[model samples]
Target: MSMKTRTVKVGPVMMGGGWPVSIQTMWKSPLAAFSGPGDPSLLAAADEIRRLAALGCDVLRFAVPDETGADSLGALAAASPIPLVADIHFDWRLALRCMDYPIAKIRVNPGNIGARWKVAEVVAKAKDKGVSLRIGVNAGSLPEDLRGMEDRAAACVAAAEREVAAFEELGFQDVVVSMKMNEPGEVERANRLFAAKYDYPLHLGVTEAGPLIAGIARNTAALVPLLKDGIGATIRVSLSDSMESEVIAGREIVACAGIKKAGVRIVSCPRCGRDSFDTHAFLARWSGRLYALKDTLEVAIMGCVVNGPGEARHADIGITGAGDFVLIFIKGEIARRAPLEEADKAFAEELDRLLG
Candidate 1:
């Protein structure tokens, strides 16, 4: 059962309100690092954003440390193909300045943005510009008053609640909420508590989730249950890696949770002594291109013919190493056979034909 919540539009994308769970990733570097006020670097960043969007990144966020960063992001936002989010901290003025641009969303912690009136000022501008606000609450950044709370998850919920109340009081309700904890258990607890208490869209993620492998593991453990129970509106797999990796992890998590069904699904067997193919290397070379495919198809990369063809017989397409050659199977029938060196090209040709 999908959790029902109010929808918040971020540019052309709609999340929550029974919408499909969307994937988001934060820019790995500061916006200022990308370009100056009027530099070609902005175009480079725009090109990268377009690539990430093709990989299924629904929203892209950048850290706005100061006015200069805000200005840089404003220019990128105008050219970006997907919705952009400005992540602001400490300075309410940055949030206000971000609103002046075409940025789709603003993320700020009410606790760090100074007093209530400062939040009100940002909220007023957000409302005036028709931009949605994401009240991000992290366990490491909880307010001083709430830091001593015995329940860390409860504390996160409280912090988010306080900020949401402030937004409501100002008659600004176009809001999204996120409560993140690095620990999987606490992350689940915090998001669960927030979901039970509020109907606002919940952006789910585990903060500081480490590098690619560990981050994917932690985020999957934390987000799977919540997503399966229909809790999250949007999700970001915060991997300390490339933005492409983060978006890929997010898409896999959503697909694993059964929240999303349209995309290429890759299934490969773990190679053992019975294997003849280098499953790992082949998958590594093709994973990105395979995932980027928009078609709803299952592609299996198996190590050997033993259980490969039988297990994935229902797959639309499959490949397995047999003897010194690779066998390409489509709909349970062998479609083509190619040597090891030509396997990739053979698979690509078959895939293109299937896609066409």
Candidate 2:
């Protein structure tokens, strides 16, 4: 059963309350990259934001290091195609400054933002503006007392609970909570514990999960179980890669966990000695484009036809090498053939036809 937690609205996107799991990614470049004197930088950032949205990134977050960064975020938020989230650290004032803009959400740990009143001030402003707030609690940034706990996952939970209590005290409930740890086991345990204790929607992720492959593996291992139990509302695959890569990884993880039922699905076999087609190169070229498609497509890029057609027979469309030529099959039946050199072009034509 899906965990029906409290729903928080970030602009037009709704998370929890049985909504589909949303994918988020943080902006890698500093806010200053788009905070130049003219509109050029902001326009460039807007283009990047649109591209991420096309790749299925539901929420885009940026770290607000200072007041200037907050101002930059406001400018970007005005033109962003998707909802923007301001990630604030020790300064509650930054969060308040961010609220002055069109930002949809503010992310900060109540414990780290100085005194309780500071948190209250930000919370009050967020409430008045109808903006949601995410209480982020990372294992590495826990309070001093919580850091000495024997169980790190429990420590994460405790920190989050305290922040949630502060929000509750002000009767502010437009909140979401996240507790991330670099270790996959701790991440899973923390999310499970939090889900059991509160109905506040949980944002799932594994912090500092390294590069593309390693990050995907760690986040998948940690998130699959929690998502399977319907514990997460929004997810971000925190990869040390491009924001686009993170969003794509999050989508695939959601699909693999069976938490999502719609979107393009790609199935390709691992190449072996009998392989004729360069499956690796073909996938690397088409993965992003294929995933960006809105239609429900089951595309299979197989190595050889020996078992390719039979193996991916259930696929809507497939391509594989058959000796000297490439074969494009539809529903297990060969639909078209092309020479090795022209395979990509032929596949593109067929793909366009299918998409059309």
lDDT of all the models against the reference?
Answer: 0.89, 0.89
Query: What are the per-residue Cα lDDT tens digits for candidate 2 across 1-356?
Result: 24899999999899888988999999997866453536797888898899899888999999999888999999888888899999999999899999999999999976578688899999999989999999999888888888889899999999999989889999999999999999999999999888988999999999999988999999999999989989999999999898988988898899878875467788898999998989899999888888778888798889897878775567888998788888898777788989988988998998888777
What is residue 135's positional error in candidate 2, in angstroms?
0.5
Worst-scoring 10-residue span by lDDT in model 1: 30-39
Considering summed lDDT, which 10 consecutive residues are worst modelled in model 2?
30-39
lDDT of 1 at 256: 84
TM-score of each: 0.96, 0.96
Candidate 2 structure, TM-score to reference: 0.96
- lDDT over C-alpha atoms for residue 3 of model 1: 83
